[model samples]
Target chain A: MENIDFSLVDWSRAQFALTAMYHWLFVPLTLGLSFIIAFMETLYVKTGNSEWKRITKFWMTLFGINFAIGVATGIILEFEFGTNWSNYSWFVGDIFGAPLAIEGIMAFFLESTFIAVMFFGWNKVSKKFHLVSTWLVAIGSNLSALWILVANGWMQNPTGMRFNPDTARNEMVNFWQVLFNPVSINKFLHTISSGYVLASIFVIGVSAWYLLKNREHQLAKKSMIVASVFGLLTTAFVVLTGDGSARNMAKYQPMKFAAMENLYVGQQNAPLVAIGILKEDSKETLHKKQDFRFQIEIPNMLSYMAFLDPNAYVPGIKDIVHGNPEHNILSFQQRSEKGKIAIRALSDYRNAKKAGNDSLAKVSQATFEANYANFGYGYYAGRDVHELIPNIPMTFYSFRIMVGMGVHFGALFLVILLLTLKNKIDKKRFILYTALWTIPLAYIAAELGWIVAEMGRQPWVIQDILPTIAAVSQLKSTSVQITFWMFFILFTGLLIAEIRIMTTSIKIGPTEDLKDSVKN
Target chain B: MKEILFNIFQFYYQGFKSMTLGKKLWTIFIIKLVFIFLVLRIFFFPNVLKSNFKTDDQRSNHVIEQLTK
Candidate 1:
């Protein structure tokens, strides 16, 4: 191979990452905020309270601003995937393209069409129809998330697919397998719950601010109660689903799990490290035997999650990185051949798993060796067996932060729930401020969690199946850099405009309730 | 039918007349310029057309093959 410029890949990756991060700043709110708005409208309808109605209208105005920016950011993502990662488009386009198309045709169109009715037809439509429209928008956003999760999950687990060298791609070998892939369902729930957490916290925070200022006190108090209730439920659910999500990661993506957990190789019961400085170069041991960097004793945590057996072996990151000697029966060329074999083996294993043929799915050492040797372009792309394993330090820290926030929010949610139930929410001054502080923190946690998930799976855009270096577009660094600058300017302007609009709307207070509502 | 056509013509004619013809012509010129810009965008800067499909002819062929298959 010729001497490739690594800087090209680095610059392009940075540019795409920046744009994606900027776009995401608008997305989670659109997902979660829309749902809270709908729920608030539901309360307004149920209670026949003008305060609830006003609160709903205020939130809807913010939601409208968020939604507009979300649409803009979302549009940019579609163009960007092709612009920034043309090679990824060619490879996974067959399987990945399906869900995106479905999302556009089904979810996005549905959401956009009904958004007008929901926002504009408040007076024109009946209360029941308006409420239904609100719900529809929420469902549309989540449905959009569902299809997107499916695409992303496929990259993590790579189910329902087989590689076609002629196309240099993995095509959908089974539609059902792709849809019901192990990671998709868990990821979808996890993503939606995070969205809810973000949405609820935003509501609670804004409402608390109003309550603290003693402006719209009645409306603020009621809104805070509703937001707290939603926030608490979703936050608790996010934590529970988070464990399930991690376990799911362990099951289908053991390498990713190993990286996240900072494991070395197949070993006995392992401890869950709560916090520690990860010295990647240093070596150590748990019980004065096995070599490792950092070790602890929690007795059977890894085995319990991964294999459901305390004694079952769980591989660590180092062991996976420096292959196990027990499985060392292959030449370099043979190992390259075996990589291709392993893919087929995995495909067969998946097929057997679906068909309930465990005996047939058990691939032999020879088969494994052949597949290990010939990992094809994946080998050249540095997705060789070693690098397919995740970055232990990065993954470990990322996973912990995500889990820690999940726990923190879980506790915070319950407190809100208890306070709201007792009708003592508004009275608790510190609690109100805590809810307010949570708003920005919740968004920050989500952004961090996503970075961990995506970045932890780095060097591969499509998990083990595709390397990141090979996946980026063939565009020059200057082109991507220019576009990035342009988007940065545009998005900043849009954000300032959105804030100005929101301030004016809040100041005006929901179109004077009736007369000015008609005038507008 | 003729009366309907005449009414439609008179409506736009009066609308333009109310704008005192010069302003109406300027608006027309701007609209034409926008259309020309859009056409040029499709030819020169395909990104402005804003589909994720690659701008190259190979992508067009690939898309056709995908459709047929």
Candidate 2:
């Protein structure tokens, strides 16, 4: 702990988080809008309605603006993996690099290739070919997301890989297991569904703006209908996948699950905190207990959600840290000891091999294999046990924000859809205003979902396998800080440019030529 | 195959030539890519494992050292 440069770790984490959050802003819109545009284009081709084509082209333009900027932040994020977390790269690169490489080589190229056709092939290609290209772009972008989320899911749960004693790194054993890991599937579905919801909100919000201004009423109404229907269906899927993700979190990363609920004591029939305002606890009471100033909880809901059994025992922070014999949970201190033993065995194996002592090396190897599951805990052998606990307040609040906003968006979509169907949308300025204002909140909820996922799994870059302190590159803290600010300024600039260009395009409205063509 | 390839090439060429706002966006995209790959990556983001160690064995040894020491 004394030798570890905490400053470098903190700065690297900050820089990566900044870049990722910014990149996320554009990705969801691209994911969901591509499909929406394709659906509109499909309608245009079927009915030969120029009005549908105008709407398709209008949304496609915004998608292009977003897609370009997304690429910029995404490239920087990939580079940061090499620059800031080189140790992590080498340690698990064999397993981790596979999914990322597939994402880049397959999904990314697929998206990039067809995106041009979707954009510029409006007149150059046949209508059917162009429509196919649009759908392909949507599939390609989501495919890219699938591979990336698979990699992230692997990090959260870390399956289908084994540590190699000879290489001192984890390597892929079963590619299929890694790809189809339950965590990966849940994560992929949940993440993309949430993106779909965000994109739906974006379309509805923009269309609502036109309605509020009394411009392009037909186009706005049509778009709102398509978007609201798509949004409602995907929001249902988000809820289902969110439930699956929570179950996975409970089973695989109990510490993160505990922090999310701010549970301090182990219990059966643990209540789920629906909403809460947390009171600040002193450092002494931090892991022991958390005081919620106000909270609404559902009886036995947390237990049922986590394990499908309302009476099932759920271990909390204290139970995890102190070890619960009744629940058969090992304490962090105990795990750390096993980790140290594993670490010692590895060192001994290396020394024995160097000295050409085969028997000693074999014995040490066996010891390492036995205690390998707790290997990461070895890094905290003498450190504070409290470090095992993640940030309770941040995780708890972010989860609430994400889930609460998600429900609000669901209701908002339904209300807007009903109002639009009844032809009462124009009269209800309040609902229109709410739909318009929800654009930023949609983004906030999406970002908070990631905050809960990433931040809640704190201290571990790869859960249980490797702690973050050991995963960072041996670089000067100042270097990371410099790049952090550099990224902040550059990404901020690009975001402003995107917003300006998108708003200008929206204000221009659909071209008058399309309206004239429809009249003809 | 040759004619098909030519048609594909021609399609993209014509698309690129016909500029509205896309050309400006592409220019921004290309410029950002250049700056990122050529300048930032080359200057600040060297692959530590590849640069510091001459071989996989050496790299793995360095990681082991970091882990245990």
Interface RMSD of each: 11.1, 1.3
lDDT of each residue in A297-372, candidate 2, tens digit only: 9999999989999998898988888899888899988999999999899999988988999999999999998998
Output the TM-score of candidate 1. 0.77
Go through the candidates in order and give each one's C-alpha lDDT: 0.66, 0.89
- Backbone clashes, candidate 1: 26
| Per-model TM against the reference | 0.77, 0.97
Local accuracy of candidate 1 as per-residue lDDT tens digits, A294-408: 5554778778777677776676655544456663423323433455465455455545655877676555323533453234322443334543444556667767776777677
Tell how far residue A59 is off in model 1, in angstroms. Answer: 1.4
Candidate 1 chain A minimal-lDDT segment of 10 residues? A285-294
